[model samples]
Target: MIVTSYGKPAVVILSVEESERLKELDRRVLRLDEMDDAQLHEMIAAEIPPELRYRIEDIPETP
Candidate 1:
């Protein structure tokens, strides 16, 4: 169950299996805000069953 600190107050209910799956994904996946585009693509490729390799692309710095 998830509780919100702000916005409309609500109660979230999850089955035991659903909760476990969500926790597993959270433990394995990096937060999008923490990843550059290349890193995000690499993670996606890695998750596929048949395995795909990707070259890392440099992120240009913002002026």
Candidate 2:
């Protein structure tokens, strides 16, 4: 359920189990954010096998 203020959702209500699951997910994201750049890159690369990766290049700015 959602509680609203000024027609905008202000708070959410969830079952105990759902709340616990969301809390765990939040903790996991926090841990990932704390990882160093190299560690994070390694983890991402490990998830996607070498066959599927592609390089991302910046596009030149258009005047």
Q: Please give the TM-score that candidate 1 achieves against the real structure.
A: 0.38
lDDT for position 63 in model 1: 50
- For every candidate, C-alpha RMSD to the true structure in Å: 13.5, 10.0
Clashes of 2: 0
Question: Which residue runs does candidate 2 get wrong by more than 4 Å?
Answer: 30-38, 46-63
Question: Which 10 successive residues of model 1 have the least lDDT summed?
Answer: 47-56
* Residue 42 shift from truth in candidate 2, angstroms: 3.9
Clashes of 1: 0
On TM-score, the candidate that comes out on top is: 2
What lDDT is obtained when candidate 2 is compared to the true structure? 0.82
Clashes of each: 0, 0
What C-alpha lDDT do the candidate models reach, one value each?
Answer: 0.76, 0.82
Query: Candidate 2 at 49: error in angstroms?
Result: 11
